[model samples]
Target: MTASPEQIEIALESKAWPFQEAQKLVERLKKFGNPKGYVLFETGYGPSGLPHIGTFGEVLRTTMVRHAFEFISDVPTRLIAFSDDMDGFRKVPGNLPNQDMLQQHLGLPLTQVPDPFGTHESFAHHNNDRLCKFLDSFGFDYEFKSATEAYKSGEMDVTLLCMLEHYDKIMRVILPTLGEERQKTYSPFLPICPRTGRVLQVPILERDLAAGTVTYRDEETGKLVEVPVTGGHCKAQWKADWAMRWVALGVDYEMAGKDLIESVKLSSAIARILGAQPPEGFNYELFLDENGQKISKSKGNGLSMEDWLRYGTPESLALYMFQSPRKAKKLYFDVIPKAVDDYLTSLAAFPEQEGKEKYGNPVWHIHSGTPPREELPVSFSLLLNLVSASNAHDKETLWGYISAYAPDIRAEDHPLLDKLVEYALVYYEDFVKPTKKYRAPTATEIAALEDLIRELEALPEDAAAGEFQTAVFSVGKAHHYENLRDWFRALYEILLGQQQGPRMGSFIALYGRDKTIDLIRKAIENPRV
Candidate 1:
């Protein structure tokens, strides 16, 4: 069950999340060999807004480990995802239809956000439903729990009593960490006021279960208040309360983003004091934007899972999830097409025996998980242009091109090629928006391209690679272009209406003389000016 040296090396090289810790856990499990105890994994949904890609990424990786454990041993594993709808709304995330509506739902259970989408009763429910759909799309089978349901069932009553019993211990940990006096009197837990979207100090003053109303008070101004407490725990203070609940619920493993690493560390200490087994932890980094900013639902700065799917299949997205989440990495919207193509190519080339031997199983783990290799057969744009220009939409044409040009690939590998074609189709659909046609090149640009085309044509048949490179460079020098890069840029601009693209010579060689010339002519006619 322990990972082989090659597996450990790959994990380290890839910097997979909990890279070292996962190895350790695997080794531990191998030693224990399916202990007569439950293996549990936990994830949470804040119900703040549309759950972002990061949320899916966390759960998917957790599922990977859970499956790994199941495959390696006979232990039964439980993956539980809790929707923390009981948590109070902190702010209205961007892309929401109504900010005012969210404010009105403040201080209320998240299950009550007035659904801006109008399909669900509340914003919290809307997001929770979306998360469920997303999880289902990714093939995760999990036990779902709602905070509202857990609280009403008195599942947390003992935990709540425990918190009350250790109120001082909670204060000691919370107050020093909070840095605000107002927070001192605040119960570690508070309910959201449905009318204001503000955190109420305590939503329940005196409960009239039969009437479904509770007497309440405003913490800030000592104003008497009342609100309906139909069901559910009002709110659990995040971080501190979250830590307590994890221990109370017996979470065996949970993956989290880097931002919460310190909080989880502190929570683990608290869990120990409460005589609860702290869950094994995996800390991961966030995906960033093209400008190197963190992608966040609150920030609204990056692509959503839905956005990605426009150009990528669920499997491609899953491969993206398989990437190590240890380092903060940016996912540029423009770069995804090529990345998806590369992932498909890698999947095609995946070493099946290597995967089985390394993981100690015959499962299709590599195909089912992991990002494709970094190198791609060609740039996505180039492939799309070839396919479009040839009007060859069939899988055979696609496979033929791969077999002919990408010698590293084989036609016998049609299964992986089919995946690539599917991925390419999705990419074309998502990113190929209608734009103005390419414009005709000016006299000087046309003259420049013609001269370079002549020089390339005049190269001796079976010319050395170096000689071919020099012939192209000579055109740039004659045209007063500073370098070969300048010549290529001008050629691309004239031919493709872009400053640069895939390597021109390699592109031409792959597509053949007639097809390349025809495509270049087409590009000239439909210049994307």
Candidate 2:
């Protein structure tokens, strides 16, 4: 459905970061006439390693801002998923095969290096294909741009020459940031060695702006050589290349990791020197691993996109990216269940939200303002717990329990829940099962359990989860537990065999009254599992 003008106005005033970012572009359109007829949003990838969660976060976040912009203003937008394949292969990644083959190709443009996987024409092509496939799976609308093609096709010629014209000024912005030694050899351009096919970072002897060429001394042989800055013969240094990309592509908005704040500022300065406004930018916090270490694609320490999707729905992964983008969070298996539940909760709430409140909803932003109306019968967390207690080996086993809980809800009717059941089984087998530890019930806990069994016995088989909850609360209170959390903790540790679990009432209601009694009786009989 098309958003009403009133809804658009609410979106314009929305405090959500995506809307706030979209507003920046709206202001940019006002300040500088968008001569391109459309605003350009770009997310860049360096094809040195395979695509990771960080890559997904960038494109997903940029896509969110793009969607927000569409709501507020009617200006057409284009997103370019740009790859810096022309970048020199600095070092071989630790994970990929053929380390020796890759080591020999260091300093060559990534596209020029042979594919270690032997899957594509070149190393960069292999990684880029993986990236495109990953993004395609998520249905992100973007045009892929290759730095090699942009340079070789003469698309960046104008900006390449413009950088040459403002060399002294661009160097002035960059040189101060480098150490004294780096400043001595630092030129804005990195020339491709004609003989060796390596991108050489040598000091420029002279530059001819008219010819768009830089002359430099070859490190391999003590001889002067000249290469055109255009036609893929030379690529600019990191900071200069980033700035040039903005001007060359007419990028209006792009976001970077918080670690790149200084790089953004430097590149912005170079963009201004090249006579174009720098793209409106955002600095989002980086994702850390379980140990609070920053996630690196090469390090392979954090969860992969494949890993997340294997155990959780894509919407859940998207929700994880949406929340607290500027605040650091751990990206690991433990975070999956919460993210999944959060997505469901937000999605379920979208239908009832009023005007401005609707604009603030994450589901609204998640689905680009037209969130679907499907109601999830069970949360991802509850499904995980259900899988744990039943030791469900397949979706059919899970469906048996879900069918009893919501008889009208069929697997065919609720496809999302069906997928969740499959994910729950996989997650339970991989993560939950191995670490689960069941401890013996103490005398006091045994007494509480026996009382709880009696309470369940008194209640009808058709009793609601809330009714079961009240009865369980009465048992805990009657036991005179010091704190309510301790009671829940004891229940989880004893019954679920995990440190945490879904609400007992709901679990009991889904698992059935007799089965829960059996589970408790077994816990009382056996000290450990």
Candidate 3:
């Protein structure tokens, strides 16, 4: 729904990142008239490898801002998922087969190289197809723009000629930043070899502004050749290409990783030099791997979209992308459960929110102000614990417990909860089960467990979580567990076989009081370690 003027005013005062970004776009439109009659939000992709989780994040976050902008402004908006397929194939990725064949085509444009996977016409096409499929699966409303197509089809000719006209100025802006060796050869324009089809990084020996061409020495023949800066003849270096693309496409907004802050600055400067405003940008912190190292597409070390989706819902992954975007966070399997639960928390809170509070909620932006009303009675984390405790191998086993706990909630009623049951089973078997280490409780813990069993026995079978929590708290306090945390830890470590666990009251209520007592008895009688 389009936000009313009152809601727009509220959104202007709202602290949500997407709304703040949308407000900036509004100011920009007010300052410089929207010539195209629409705001363009772009997310660039380097088709050197398969699109990774970071790639999804940039587009997802950009889409969020675009949605927010739609809410506040009457102007239409477009999101372009741009691919840099005109870039040179610098190195063979480690993951693909036929590395030797890839090595043979190393210096050529990505679109000119043969597909190693034998899936598409070229390496870039293969990755680009994967990228399109990736974004399509997420149902992102976007237009795909290829760098090669943009260059070859004359879409970038105006910007190319403009850069050629300001060659000296562009050089002045770029040369000072490069090393002496790089400075000697760095040209804003990279010419495609007429013979071999490789993009050349040679120095511009001369510029013909009238002809809109740059003269360069061809490395293969050692002869100076002049090529038109327009059409498929030349492409700009990455920094310049980024700026040129912004002006050529009239991009109003784009975002990148924090590592590209310097790059963004250079691109913005180049965009200004090219006589257009650079897009409003958000520099988000990069994701880290399980080891806390920066996630690299080449390294293939962090969680892939496939990996996350294998055990978490799409909404959960979207939540991970939504929360604290500027803060660096480890993206791995361990973070999935919390992300899922956090999404649930936000989804649950959305209905109660009023005015700007609704705008502040991530789900409002996530679903474009019409977030679904589906309710999840249990969190993803709690379901995982239930899987661990019950040794559940299928959703049916979980539904038995879920039905017992919330008798009113049917599997048909809570489809998301039903899916979570399946995800929990897979997560437990794959990630949680192998890592589980249960140890025999000490005499103090045993006594505490015995007291807890007595309390449980006193309560009715249909006791609520609060009552179970009160009983557990009383038992811990009576047993003189100084920290009380140690008592809870004992419960988790001994019964659940993991360091972290769900709230005991909820887990016990869901898993059944009698079943929990049986688990504690089994733990007390056995030496699991």
- Give lDDT tens digits, candidate 1, residues 375-439: 45555566655554444656677667666676677645544455656556555444442321345
lDDT of each: 0.64, 0.91, 0.90
For all predictions, the C-alpha RMSD in Å is 6.3, 1.1, 1.1
Q: Quote the lDDT for 296 in model 1.
A: 81
In lDDT terms, which candidate is top? 2
Q: Candidate 3 lDDT, tens digit per residue, 381-452?
A: 899899889988888899999999988999887788888888999888999999999888999888989999
Off by over 4 Å in 2: 1-4
Q: What is the C-alpha local distance difference test score of candidate 3?
A: 0.90
- lDDT of model 3, residue 284: 99
CA displacement after TM-score superposition, residue 378 of candidate 3 (Å): 1.5
Q: For model 3, where is the 10-residue window of minimal lDDT?
A: 520-529
lDDT per residue (tens digit) for residues 1-529 in model 2: 3357887777766688898998899899999999999999999999999889899989999999999888788889999999999999998889889999999999999999999999899999999999999999889999999999998999999999999999999988899999999988999899989999998888999999878899999776899998999998999899899999999999999999999999999999999999999999899999999999999888788998899999998889999999999999999999999998999999898888887777888888788878888886678888888888887898898899989988999989888888888888998899999999988889999999999999999999878999899988999999998797889899999998888888888889999989988888888988565
- Candidate 1 similarity to native, TM-score: 0.74
Clashing pairs in 2: none
Q: Using Cα atoms with residue i matched to residue i, what is each candidate's TM-score against the true structure?
A: 0.74, 0.98, 0.98
